[model samples]
Structure formats: structure tokens, C-alpha cells
Target: MKLGRLNHIGVATPSIADSIRYYREVMGATEITEPFDLPEQGVKVCFVSTPGETGVNEALHSALNGTQIELIEPLNSESPIAGFLAKNPAGGQHHLCYEVPDIAAARAWFEGLGKRILGSTRIGAHGTPIFFLHPKDMMGQLTEIMETPKAGH
Candidate 1:
């Protein structure tokens, strides 16, 4: 299957509050969405616009059509993000997300290539289907494949 757009870079942080501060105060980010929790995913996440990109928070219309930075922090000890933070207390890039026209097609293609898909497709922070690819098959970077959101989402 053909790859789609680079959606967002996922960052695992020990604290979303701290990361938000860094993006806003030091990085001068002006368009950050408020942090929200995904209990099913066991993380709290926020989206920060890439530096100098406007309309990052305008997802309903006119938002940046390219890459974004997604800040994720563990919601509890059992959270998946907790393990990431344990390995990196200072936090770092956790994964790269790319949009796909059809998630099932993408999954099938990856499986055909013998790439390990981490888990069943699940609803992600964007309210769309998403799944992760193991870093081993992806040159040391965790990859997230997401179904492109429909218009008006």
C-alpha cells in the first residue's frame, strides 16, 4: 500500500505540563491544543504546532496539513507511556505517525512484508483507527499508522 502524509511526531514526556511549558515559553509555540486524557490508551496527550506554523489548533478547518508534535504522558503506572518514560525520564521522541487511506490495507501490506504490527487497530488520540509498528522492523523508530480522518474531523 502507498504511504500517506506524515501526520505527527509522538513524544513521550514525564509530564505534559512541563512539556507544554517548554513548547510555549522557550519554544514560543502559540497554538497548542489543551491536553486531554485517553484512558483507553492510558496516556494524556497534547498537540503542539511545529515552530512557525499557524492554525495548528484549527483542526476543524485550516489547520496545518502536515506534521505536528504530539506530547504524551502516562496516565498511571500501568500506562504504556510509563515504560517509555522509565527508559527516558527526560523524555524524547517516541514514535512517528503517518496517515493512511485505509488502515486495514496498510496493516496487510506491512504484514506481507513481515513487519511486526504491535497490536490490533485501536482508536487513537485523533479519534481515528491507528496501530503501531515495532521499532525493530522500522530501523529503530516506532511507527504509527493511522487512518486519515474524514473531513470536518
Candidate 2:
């Protein structure tokens, strides 16, 4: 049940293109990954990396492992994010993802604590196992638990 890091903040967006523009122009984000579609998840997603500690050192940047903004747009009307956007047409923060050392152990630990797990663990956008914690159990913030990505990922 050991926690690794706050991986990313999930942002439900009606349009990935517009979101990317906002991140770049308004938030000063310069490290956004290209948007890609995940048909299984029914969402188009991208990662926007925040500028790390004030330094020009690439090595230090890697070490810092700055959290990312995971912009998510529905791939179709039936997508979960589409539902979220129904309530928030402008779109907004959806969930917070935290990395766990072991996905199974983390799930069990959460269950033992009476925290509802939203669904079965599955491969996530990061290419690692991940699951969601129910918003009702987390004071209304839907939370995501992800298995730490392997060393080279």
C-alpha cells in the first residue's frame, strides 16, 4: 500500500485541442505530449508536464518528476468523460491520480478502509495498472490509484 507519487491530475475537457491551447497559453505549459485516443477507455488523452524546479538541468528535471495534467476528452457520446462534461460543459478537474507500489495491495488496503473501488484494475494511459476510488468515499474528489510505471517507462 505504499504510495509513490501524485502522478497526474485528470481534467475532463470537451475539446483536447482547446485544452492544449489553454495549457500552453494561459498556464505556460511547454511540455505537453501529443494527444492520443484510447478506444478502450473511450477517451482522447494527453499529458501536460509542468515546468519543474527552477533549473536548466535536464537530469534534475527527470529527478523532480513533476506531476502532469492529464487532459481527457470523450472519444464518443457514451464515454464517461462525456457524462462528466454534461454536468460541466466547460469541463474541469475530474480526478487525482497517485502511484502505488503495488496495485493489488493498494486495492486491498482501500477496501479494508471501506473506501469503494470504482472498477477493476486495468492498464491505464501510463501503460501501468490503475483503478479509481469512488468520489463518495473521497469527499467528492474521484481519486485514481496507479501502479508505479517500471523504471524505464
In terms of TM-score, the best-performing candidate is 2
Question: Using Cα atoms with residue i matched to residue i, what is each candidate's TM-score against the true structure?
Answer: 0.89, 0.90
Which ten contiguous residues of candidate 1 have the minimum total lDDT?
A: 57-66
Candidate 1 stretches with Cα past 4 Å from truth are 51-64
lDDT of each: 0.90, 0.91
For every candidate structure, what is the RMSD over all alpha carbons to the true structure, in angstroms?
Answer: 4.3, 2.9
Report the alpha-carbon TM-score of model 1 versus the true structure.
0.89
67-100, model 1: which lDDT tens digit per residue? 6899999999999889988889899999999999
- Inter-residue clash pairs, candidate 2: none
lDDT of 1 at 53: 55
Clashing pairs in 1: none
